[model samples]
Target: MSQRLRLLSVLASSLLLSACVSSPKKPAPVEDRNPQPARTAAPASAPVPPAPTAPEPKPAPGAENAGKPGYYTVKPGDALIRIALDNGQSWRDVAKWNNLENPNRIEVGQVLRVVPPGVDAAAVAARPIASAPRAEARPLDAKPAAASASAASSAAVTAAKEPAVKDKDKDSAADDDTLAWGWPVANPVTAGFDEQRNKGLDFAGKPGDAVLAVADGRVVYAGSGLRGYGNLVIIKHNNTYLTAYAHNRAMLVEQDQVVRKGQRIAEMGSTESDTVKLHFEVRKLGKPVDPAKLLPAR
Candidate 1:
């Protein structure tokens, strides 16, 4: 019975050891029930560039030479004051140039050398003004017959002193003296010259009409290289004058060709104009002048 009790105790100990060795492991607790999505580093943003701008244009050359005092020839009927204003100089400069005590003493065919401000005052003061020549008159005392003949002679002299009526008639046919003269086309002038705005004159004509030159010159340029002057023709008159014709349908004269006055140089067209017309410009020393002052009266 004692042996049976020992075996039973041993069996109980073995059972306890087996229970300790066969125990299961427990899982760790989760903060969230559902698993979160995997997070990636955000992509770096790119930098943007700025837009570009256009370049500015350069000023015209020799513009600084303008308004400088210089010498000018006095044509027929040119007043001293008028010449001074045309050259951008003052009337005082004209008086000082000619050494005139009175500004109204200027005569035709005179060469006046004008000086600008801050010039030599002593040189101007040294020059003497020219005076007009005087004529002697006949005596009044004489016989009655001689007096009657003298009175008749005086009437003739009085008539000669008066302005010639025939001169008034010829005044309308006077020649234009303005530089860079040119005819627009074989038609009436439709538009006159405007310096700042138009820069030229327009002649009224049908499409494909003949255009002529106003004076003898050589064609310097005969292409449309210049902007706003389509199918252009430029003629060099002298050293100081140039004439330009634009919007032509056909050019009869080529570059460097010598052309005479009233010669056909081009045909009128509407390439640059709404209506068919000739665009004519006369430039004197690179400056534009009124074409009406240069063209003959119709």
Candidate 2:
């Protein structure tokens, strides 16, 4: 029993010594001299939007004639009589054919039939007024405002300076006949063609002075129907050319009457003008050209 006690004491002593010698504390963490920074993702950039652009104006209604024969697209400032004259038809006939309750109440962009039924519109041998606004002229004799379209009308016409040719006008451009021209009056020109103001030549003359036909043509329009014209006359020389005599005291020739160049067509007077004068205009494809370009040199 004494020997067993000695061995047990020795084993206990060994365990006690082992317990007293604890494991060496871990070496202090070595200081890092160089450290790599942690990587981070960049926020996505916003996309830039494209710039907006302006939209083009839509075409007017009835801009297309709908391929209907004898149909005319009424433009701004179109007088029924003027439409009739342009198409070589009487205003009454046009009114009858269209069954217009009030001929003067036509609307802008309204399509009109200027030719009677059963008649070939192509054989009318006249150029329709350009689809653009009809060219306007200021009268020398009337007040500045008086030169505008008739007060009774709602829409007034203004000139289109340097207008581009329309498809309809272009179609007839190649077929228009070149013609001889003469002066409509023998008076000093008081005013000349101005695209912005005066659209034709103004001749200072006395009342009853003879207004001559500038070319041999049929009288397509001879009446006091147009505003600011005052007993005006429009002679259709050909499919492409026409001449206008405005502010006449008396129209000697009638509509549909054929007149020769240098023949007296009207007596010059202040009808819609301030002074006794003759306002002469030359239209090619319903576009006013400077009369000086067509008239003979004096």
Candidate 2: worst 10 consecutive residues by lDDT? 154-163
Tell me the TM-score of each prediction against the true structure. 0.41, 0.54
- Candidate 2: tens digits of C-alpha lDDT, residues 131-190: 434534222122222222332121111112212222211111223445777899888999
Model 1 over residues 1-298: C-alpha lDDT tens digits?
A: 9999999999999998998889755667768879889999988988767676767755332234333335555555555533532333334445665576756555444556554446653343322112211112111111111123443454355335432222111111222353334465658877877655676788888755777877866665565543355566776565345677887766666655666677777677765567778888776544566777777666
Please state the error at residue 98 of candidate 1 in Å: 39
Residue 3 deviation, candidate 2, in Å?
99
**Candidate models: Cα lDDT each:** 0.56, 0.68
Cα RMSD for candidate 1? Answer: 24.5
What is the Cα-based lDDT of residue 174 in candidate 1? Answer: 20
Clashes of each: 0, 3
Q: Highest TM-score among the candidates is held by which one?
A: 2
